[model samples]
Every structure is written in structure tokens, then in C-alpha cells.
Target: MKTLLLAESHPPTLEHLTGLLSQAGYTVRAVSDAVMALEHFSADNPDVVVLGVDLPRVDGQHVVHLIRGHSQG
Candidate 1:
């Protein structure tokens, strides 16, 4: 599946998740913040989004809601 990964600022965790997702045959676009994630979302139209709860500006729940809204539309 195509996946959008809203990456954690913590390097190791992001790297590990990226490796696992890649291994599972997911095409991932990693973004470090909600703004970037949202920007990428419009263009990428990923099948799923994996968001970090501790993200800056916007949190994971917010991201989830945004994705769900997009899905509904």
C-alpha cells in the first residue's frame, strides 16, 4: 500500500519505522511535521497514514481527522 509516514523528530524511531514499512512493501513518504504531511497528502493521496502523536504544530489525532475528512470527500 502507499503510506504517508508523519515522522517523529527522533531519528532512530523514524528510521526503524521506515525500514519496517519498506520491508512490508509499502511506498512511504516521510514528513517531519503536520504541515509537510498535509502538503504531501494532497499530492501523494496515500492509502494510509502513520502519524506520530508527539508531532509539532499538530498532533496525530488531528492528522487522523484530516485524513478521514479527505477519505469522506
Candidate 2:
């Protein structure tokens, strides 16, 4: 099974996407803010990541940089 990390700001969108992805056989970890997204990214190390640029707390762009930094060191 593949793991997916989903970071979305909108509650409805997050739920809808999560449901769809789950049904498609992915192990999904859905979050609404960048902090939690980063936390999950570190802990889960998912195979795929779906991020919303308008995410709260830290935003998606910053989170991407952080994730990359973590991956490197």
C-alpha cells in the first residue's frame, strides 16, 4: 500500500480528497495546517504528497522547503 500526505486548508476539500484517495487504496494522512503537515511528513515519510498553497500556519511553499531540508539533513 502507498502512503499519501495531504495538506489542505479547506475542511470540506480535505475530507473529500481524503475519502477519494482512501478509496483508491492509499493510506492517507490529512491535515489542515502546515505545522501538522510538517509533523506528519517527518513521521510518516509518505510516498506521495498533496499540498494546498493556501494552507494555514506556515503555508505550503515554506513547508516544501522545510521538507526538502529535512530530507537532505
Candidate 3:
């Protein structure tokens, strides 16, 4: 199964998106913040990642930068 790391700060949107991705056959690992997102990114090494721009503490772009810094990806 394909794995997806979903970083969504809003609960309703998170649930809805998770459901949609799950229905489409993705094994989703949902997180509410950039910190958790990065942690999961390292631990899970998911094939896909969906991050919310309005995430708390840190934004999605920075998270992407951090992820890229951690790998050639």
C-alpha cells in the first residue's frame, strides 16, 4: 500500500481529507503540526506528503525545506 503523510491543522479538514485519501487507497499518517510532520516523515518515510499551508508554529514551505534538507528528495 502507498503511504501518505498528511499535515493538517484543522480537525474537520483533516478528517475529511484523510477519509478521501483512504478511500482512494492511501495509507495515511495524519499529523496536526510541522513538528509531528517532520517526526513522521523521518520515521515513516512515506511515499507522499500533503501539508496544510496554515499549519501552526511552522508553515508548510518550511516543513518542505526541512524535509528536503534531510534528503535529496
Candidate 4:
């Protein structure tokens, strides 16, 4: 089974997306904050990540950079 890391700040969007992904058979981890999202990404090492551009603490672009950096190092 594939894993998905979902970083969405809005509650409704998060719920909706989570439901859809779960129904599709992906193991999903949903987070409202970018920090938690990154933490989960490191721990889960998800096959795919769905991020909201507007996020708290850290934004989506920065998170992508972080992921890239971590992958390289």
C-alpha cells in the first residue's frame, strides 16, 4: 500500500481529502500545520505528499525545499 502525507490547514478540505484518499486505499496522514507535516513526512516517508500552499509556521514551498534538502543529506 502507498502512503500519503497531506498538509492542509482547512478542516473541511482536510477531512474531504482524507476520506477520498482513504477510500482509494492509500494510508494517509493528515496534518493542519506545516511543522507537523514535515515531522510526519520524516517519520512516515510517504510515497506522495499533498500540501496546501498557504500554511502556518512553514509554507508549502519551504516544506518542499526542506524535503529536497533532507533527501540529499
Candidate 5:
């Protein structure tokens, strides 16, 4: 399965998440901000998006709403 991670800009955690997902045999796409997350969503079309709530520019709840809207409509 594919996983898209919208994680904090902290490098260590981001690296760890990527490593873990890769080890789990997932096709992982990791992005720091919400804009890139949306871009990845359109480009990668991941099966799941793991979003961080304290996101910059656009927050996670808004992302969730947008994804839901896109999925439904």
C-alpha cells in the first residue's frame, strides 16, 4: 500500500517516519507542508495520508476536509 506523510519540519522525526514506512514495505511520499501534501496527493494518489495537526499555512483539519470533499465529489 501507499502512504503519504505530512509531518513536521523536524528532520529526525521525518527521517524516522520515512525509514519506518519504507521498512514496512509501503510506497512512501513525505512532505513538510500542507501545500506540498496536496501536490503529492494529486501527483502520487496515495492510499492513505498521515497528517500532522499543527501544520503550517494550512492545518490538518482543513486538509482532512479537503481530502474528504475530493473523495466524495
Candidate 6:
């Protein structure tokens, strides 16, 4: 099964997206903050990442950079 790393600050959006993606058959790991998102990304190494631009603690763009830096792909 494929996995998705979802980093969204809005609670409703997060819940909605998680449900939608889960129904679509992807394993979703959702986080409300960028720091936790990055941590989860490192631990889970998800196949895809869905990020909210406006994030707390760190920001989506930085998280993307971190992922790119660590990822072989």
C-alpha cells in the first residue's frame, strides 16, 4: 500500500482530506505542524506528501526542502 504524509494546520481540512484519501486507499499520516510533519516524513518515508502552505513552527516550503534534502528521489 502507498502512504501519504499530510501536513495541514486547519483541523477540518485535515480531517476531510484524511478521510478522502483514506477512502481512496492510501495510508495517511496527518500532522498539524510542520515540525511533526517532518518528523513523520523521516520516520514514515511516505510515497506522497500533502502540505499546507501556512504551517506552524516551520512552514511547508521548508519542510519540502528538508524532505528533498533527505530524500534520494
Which candidate leads the pack in lDDT? Answer: 3
How far residue 53's Cα lies from its native spot in candidate 3, in Å, is: 0.7
Per-candidate Cα lDDT values, in order, are: 0.79, 0.95, 0.96, 0.95, 0.77, 0.94
**TM-score against truth, every candidate:** 0.83, 0.94, 0.96, 0.95, 0.86, 0.94
lDDT of 3 by residue, 7-69 (tens): 999999999999999999999999999999999999999999999998899999999999999
Clashing pairs in 1: none
Residues 1-73 of candidate 2: C-alpha lDDT, one tens digit per residue: 9999999999999999999999999999999999999999989999998999999888899999999899999
Give candidates' CA RMSD values in order.
1.7, 0.8, 1.1, 0.7, 1.6, 1.3
Q: Is candidate 3 or candidate 5 better by TM-score?
A: 3
Clashing pairs in model 6?
A: none
| Between candidates 4 and 5, the TM-score winner | 4
Pairs with steric clashes in candidate 3: none
Give per-residue CA lDDT, model 4, range 1-73, as digits (tens).
Answer: 9999999999999999999999999999999999999999899899999999999999999999999999899
Q: Which ten residues in a row have the lowest lDDT in candidate 3?
A: 64-73
- In model 4, which range of ten residues has the least summed lDDT? 37-46
Lowest summed lDDT across 10 adjacent residues in model 5 is found at 1-10
